[model samples]
Target: MSEGNGPTEGQDKVQSSAPPNAVWPLRDKEGNVTVPFAYGTIAFWQGKRAQEYQTHKWHVYVRGANNEDLTPLIERVIFQLHPSFNNPTRVIDTAPFHVCELGWGEFEITIRIFFHDGPEQGLEIKHMLKLFPRVGEPSQKKPVVSERHDEFVFNAPNEGLLQRIGMCNTRMPNGGPAWATIEPFFSPLNEHEELLRIQAAQRRVQAEITLVKEELENEEQILSFLQDEVKKLEPSIVKKPPGT
Candidate 1:
């Protein structure tokens, strides 16, 4: 459902400083800025039949988790599409980072994230483009969405970046808090949903393990009974004379 990236070191030079007590989500005591983001593709079918070379209309995007605006931290988002299309390298320098296209096939998409501060190196991620429904699944009016959630950890960030992080007013759904108080980018409601999904998967796996163990035990018992029966019949089995 989601994936995470390793922590990256920010510029060591402090551009300025902020109040030590300012509250911000994903800001640890060590002044690290952890920004949660997601990237995926959403496709809509174009009628029941393929239109020339195009079968569907789709858009690929990168954005903050829970649709949070990432304009403050990210400088730009670069998407490298398949070479078959004209001008495969696309760049978006705004909050709505996306690219729209029409195609009938799937390929690997390479995304690069550039920061506002001086890291000099942009973070690179790879995502597989999906165009078809999964096996045994039916299609409907709803768009097919394939997404992955992840985080960008900037260790020892500079002060200008810190100020921007502090200025961001993260709102909780259903009007919980004016400011982001809890853990990372996700609201409490979303977090709870994700937790429940994980728990359900774990339960299913555990039940399967138990069933396999029981089946193995039954098989062992049957094999042991057969072996014992063979031992009992060994003496009674007719023996032919060597001369015969």
Candidate 2:
């Protein structure tokens, strides 16, 4: 898949009645719950003299967009680290969900997110850890930041989940959830802001496609003109046959 075109975000739907053993709240009119989130790593390079294996310190985290607390919607997060590490599997069950360590090598980290309600299956995701700067980019003291934005869609959600989602989206001073009172690293996503970002990316890709098409058309025109000129000269360029 192209960049920003990875797997679809998590979508949980309830199709049939719950099992006899399980009890869930009545379905709400909202019908769908969307929780926007971002996951990736932030890494800082140690000085050149540091050990090769410990040249970079990094933290891998899954956070609600703009650093909003995810405790309301997420029950816990399971992170599978590289096998080289001792006890490679780690579980976090609170806000500021993250793991911190020192390492130089890069690898793909597996993350599984469990929701607070039913749908026993957890959403699985993979992220590639990057520590070094790309070619042609200047190196600096600032940490390298790489993250992807996505949202979870819960369809036909029960009343309990709808209430939790409501708490997450509501603003403070209006009986919002406790987490809303906390400060975020960045401004919260405004209405339609996610749509606007997607549209902007699409526009950039479309512009590049248009330029390529124009170049192809120009080359085709040049080829056609050369073929016509060659046809015009053929008669004179061809010597008459001896019999003719």
Candidate 3:
């Protein structure tokens, strides 16, 4: 990731076919790039878990153009949650940039995103928290209403990070794309999907074990019948041994 302060507005604009302005593009697997934009969402709502005291809920999610969740690329996300909660300003440095926090009331949340690889290309965004919907408002399905799409620019990004950001950057250090470092942070790593996968795997294993047990029982029954028949044939042979 690039290491520096946020880029100015003028640094991000491109007026001609060739990028002439100051903005330098990070390399993806494709090639040397000029300006790259990623999708970002900032949203907030009332508590889903239902706390005795009213608390607001919020999250910031980043993703690639293909709609792949990129929340994991974030190295540290500083959230200005609210004034009421203990340590209202929280800094989360981990995978899953979509932060979950509680506050006593509703307010605007200012978020600062720091990328694990591109520290210099840090981004600042805002989201307004809504506790209650308007009266007679049509029921909406999405949880968070305040969402946005933002284009972020990186100037002179390090070779390592270039491979990770663009549509393509193949010459990464580990023989993988540069984005490999941040790949683990994708929001798909969230607990819900992971739990489902584990449950499904466990079910498959149980079914296999049960089937094997039933097959073993059938084999045992067959073996027992064969043994009894052999004993009866031995008795018959003994009775006829004198003349036959």
Candidate 4:
């Protein structure tokens, strides 16, 4: 009843001989002209014989009685005959029984049944068929910056920084009284680098402004000196003084 599970029980086996009022033709291993049987629902052969029903492979089919239609009862029979209904790998396919050949008085119905290995094998077969399509396909690549850098340093606040600085000092050479005398230039080197850039930019701007102001002052001083000389020369060039 569940998916992929075959019949559970009550599957009747084909008989060796034919039943009453049934007719069936017998064929050789190659399906050549053989013999015909009368009055039998099922037929059988001695030793090993090859019979093909549904699958390409040939199997032996033994005849049985029960002249009634076997198609309707097939489901019940398979369910009874198969091992377990819960097996994960088993799959069954069934078809309506049909009359292959007509005999004297008896009739025979041919049933086709098939069983598949499992889903995994079927999937593997499919993948094998698709290998050429998957070949030469490009794989995804990740950016270099996606990975974290181990050398990147993280700095803490003043109190924590001082603690770490003190710890480093304890391991220094001639560490006793030198600590008080030597100024601990906690060169927040990392911080200092940033501060250095900011200070450099500020100094450049200030220098530019100072140069512009000095140029303007120099120009004003030169203009005043020129005006004073021009005024003193104007009196000398004028016509006779008061004594004249």
Q: TM per model?
A: 0.60, 0.60, 0.42, 0.20
lDDT of 3 by residue, 1-244 (tens): 1011211111222221111222233344545343322333322333355454533333334333223333434567787755665565768564334444443345677888777478665888776665455554323233434433334555666766664554232111221221332233223223355457668989999999999999999999999999999988986674546656
Residue 13 displacement (Å), model 2 = 36
Per-model tally of clashing residue pairs? 0, 0, 15, 23
lDDT of 1: 0.64
Please write out the lDDT profile of model 4 over residues 49-149, one tens digit for every residue: 32222111111111112122222212211111112224323223231121111111111122223212111112110000010112443222210010000
Backbone clash tally (model 4)? 23
Residue-level lDDT for 126 in candidate 4: 8
- Model 4: worst 10 consecutive residues (lDDT sum): 143-152
Scanning candidate 2 in windows of ten residues, the lowest lDDT window is: 1-10
- Give residue 155's lDDT in candidate 3 (0 to 100): 61
Q: How far is each candidate from the true structure, as Cα RMSD in Å?
A: 12.6, 12.8, 19.2, 42.4
Cα misplacement distance, residue 96 of candidate 3 (Å): 1.4
